[model samples]
Structure formats: C-alpha cells, structure tokens
Target: MQTQKSFEATTQGILYLVPTPIGNLEDMTFRAIRLLKEADRIAAEDTRNTQKLLNHFEIQTSQISFHEHNSKERTPFLVEKLLSGETIAQVSDAGMPSISDPGVDLVKAAIEAGITVVPLPGANAALPALIASGISPQPFYFHGFLPRKKKDLNAELETLNKRQETIIFYESPHRLKALLDQIEKVMGPERKIVLARELTKRYEEFIRGTISEVSEWAQNEQIRGEFCVILEGNANPVSENETAEWQNWTIKEHVEQVMDTEEMSSKQAIKEVSQRRSQPKRDIYAAYHEI
Candidate 1:
C-alpha cells in the first residue's frame, strides 16, 4: 500500500504521465503545456511524432524514445533518471499515455522504485466518444481493441454481449466492417451501435444506428479514419437462473439446440455454447463432433 502525494516535495524526481491531444491541437491543455516545458526530459512513444507536437507548442524539452518495442531497455534507464532527481514527462503519440499506448511498463517501474507518478487529466478518446454515443454513460466497459482472429473475436464478443454496461472499443478503419459484421452476428442486428471517427477533428463524424443499419452503411460507404465504437448494453442480460435452463444440457445438445432455435450455423452455435458453458472452444468442438 503506497500513498502518493503528487505535489509533495521530494528528493527523488516525479514521473508525469501527460496526455496529448488526440486530434485537435487546441485540445492540448495549459497545464500539459507547462509540464512539458518544465520537465527535465520527455519520454515519448514516437519521438518523430512527438517532435511535431513539441514544435507546435514551441516546447524545447529534449525527448528519449520509450515505446512498446524498446520499453524493456528504456524503463530501467528512465527509472534511474527519476531516482537521480531528474523530472520526466511521458507522452504517447496522442491522447493519454498507457491507454492502448506504451507507458504502463515505465509507470510500474516508477511506482516500484518509490518514485511518484503524477497523471495529468486531459484529452482521451473513450470518454468523448461515450458521452456523444447517446448510450447510458454511468456504467461503461472500455475494451480498447478486440481479438483479431474470427474465432477469438467471436468468443470475446459473446462474453461482452452479457454486459449490462455500455461497451466501448477501438478499431482501425480497415477492420471496421468486419468487426461490425461480427457484432451483428454475435449480438444480433437490432443492437444499437455508434461509430465515432476523427474525433475532435474538423472531419469528425458519427454513424449511429442498429448494427444491421451500420453494416449496410459500411457496405456502400468507403470506410476511413480510426473508430471508437460504442455499443448499447444487453438490456436483458442472462442471469444464473437464466443459464439454469441449459446448464445441465450436454455440450453437444446445447450446440444443437442453439443452432436449431436461433437458426445459427454450427460454427456460430459452437461459439455461443462455449461462451455459455465457460468452456474451451476446442473442447466444445470435440464434444459436439464426438472427436
């Protein structure tokens, strides 16, 4: 149990987790600017990209590369600098560091070494997309990126489909259509979803509709920009008692029933059965196939 008084004076240097503007330069806060100007050094995910931000703000602080590929090599070095009382500010390419970025390893090292980690609140992509989604905001689950593989993505979506809170996800433009297709397959076409793109930028856009509608829209429109997908929560989540109806059934029987009742293909039925039983997909497959 470690208590951190972020502003308290200490002999050791503090590590500031600064957030950069996601898209708009105006989103950069005064405090973030000041901290960047005052810090002894800035540890950036991409020095070239961060150099642009530094140039825009006229911040002359020197930067050291500390990204995902080189984190293992740089974390110890950064920790040493902090121990030597050299203040450091860590920034990602955009938005908050460590949220789908490369700052967690260094933050963990700083904390373990008894160094203070100060996080400055500023721009982030998730919240802005959530509030504008017209979905309930109180309870939200932010799952940054989903699995890439079809089976893995399907299984993951099946679990998320049980959540009572709004779900948020980040997806690249190239994969958005495929993702929406999977969402429609797993969560049903009627489920509401919003796709927010180029957030805070002049070309920012929001495509809101049922999963089926969005899927149809994607078919005709040329997809562009990163997306923050906000999905409405399961209005009628399955409870333990709800699972009781099929809990006692054999895996094969469960898959057969789901395929027959929902009119889903065997593969989709197997994925759903695995999720419901909390069993491995391969195991369910073997049982269903009598392999």
Candidate 2:
C-alpha cells in the first residue's frame, strides 16, 4: 500500500529570515547554514555579497536580489513562490536583515499573506557593544545609524543625552570621527563612550574613554570598517544632600530647589526631585504651579 504522508507534509512553505555574520565567517551558525542549504531559493539584500558568503560555505542554492531598492517590487513574487510550496530563505549582506537593512518589508508582506515566517538566531552588533560597554545593559536603546546631516544628528544626540539607559548606534568608517566630535559637543565632553570597530573580524578594536578622548584618538587614525558606539547615559542629576533637603520641603520649594541647582526645566526638575525624594512626581508638579 502506497500509504502515508502526514500532516507535516501538507504544511505551507516557510519564509526563513536568516542572519549572516557581521564580520567573521566562522560566526555563521550551523542552523543558518542548514536552513540556507535546504531552502528552495535564497533572497538576498545583495546577491553579490551573499554569493561570496555562499561560496565560502560551499552552499549551492540559487540567489536573487531582494533589497530596499527592489523589495516592494519583489516581495509579491517571492510570496507567490511560497504559496506554491517553495521554502525561501532571506539574508542580508551582514548582520540581521530588516535591522538597518532590507528584510522588514518582505517579512511583513509574508505575514500578511499568511505565510509562516521563521527567524534564525545569529550574530548582531548592538548586543555585543552594550554588554561589553561596562554600562548598565538592562535599560539600553539601539539607535541604529546616526543621521548624516549635522543638525538632525545633533538633535538626535540631544534627545539621547537625557536618557538614563545606555545608547547604542552604528557608524560608518569614514564618518566615525565626525560622529564622535558631534557626540562630544552635544552630550558633554566627559560623557563616557565606547567604540567597537571591525567587530568579530581581524583587527577588531575597542576604544573606551570620555567622548573627547575617543574623538581625539579617532582623529589620529585612518578609520576603517563598521563601528558600534555605546554611550553611557547622563549621571543622576540630583545629589544625596539635595534629595534629603527636598524630602523636608513643600513640593513647591522642592521644585524650586531642583531648578536652582540644576538647569532643568520646571517639569523635569519636579520629576527629578520626586524620584530622588521618594515623592510623587505629580505632587511636585502640582506644588510647582500652586495647584
């Protein structure tokens, strides 16, 4: 009896989102390799770049371009193949796709079409930078790439300066020095910063110091390769003595004191002092306006 295929055999084709290595080829996971090899077709952000990687692993899967420039036009085509039961794998040139790369749109399209999407765990730059930054990693933000325009980038940095969590960002080699200089001017020269260069590759280097110091060092070298920047958040703006004094004062007086010592706005001052003194932020705000 020619009997039996199971429920698994009837499953629709899956869209596997695989992450390629950022730098070292050895960092590529076995599971990623298996998925790529087993897939019916591989959609890459850059066929040439992905081809180099496939060549290294001796993977013979056919590749097609599926990047930002053509993703809108190509997603539907790939989806049609999935509907026909062809397993497809997607990869960016480096790191995770759809993350500062092309992959998000396609993934969204696949999901809307009711196709299964699978993400393969692999290498990334942000986590490594945050963990090695020697800063509190529990509350951290990934800011991706800085804006190329000076004014916009500075404005972006200004907002980050107020955060109490570690901030991570990616920078290009040629623009690394410029970014460091801007970070110093906007976030204060003494703000702690870590520069991770050419991560996981030969000549990988980590430079850790005050923003000004790193900026100076970066100027003396020919910057190369990708960078992951980690900036330490603003220190607690309130002092222990200030906290104790605020605890004894009326909310209005506490807000005034916070404003006088720190150059913070009234609202921000109230929030800061309230947290320091274990008081409600709203109470401080209400008293600041005599409500």
The prediction achieving the highest lDDT against the true structure is 1
Assess every candidate by TM-score.
0.84, 0.78
RMSD of each candidate relative to the true structure: 7.8, 9.4
Candidate 2: tens digits of C-alpha lDDT, residues 1-291? 223222235457888889999999999999999989999999998899999999999999999899989988999999999888999999998989888999898888878877778787889998887888787787888889888999999899767766788888998899998898877766656567899888888888899987778889999988888899998876664445754665678777777876888888887887665555534456667778888
Q: Residue 135, candidate 1: how far off, in angstroms? A: 0.7
lDDT by residue (26-74, candidate 1, tens digit) is 9999999999999999999999999999999999999999999999999
lDDT of 2 at 138: 72
Candidate 1: lDDT over CA atoms?
Answer: 0.91
Best of the candidates, TM-score: 1
Give lDDT per model, in order. Answer: 0.91, 0.82
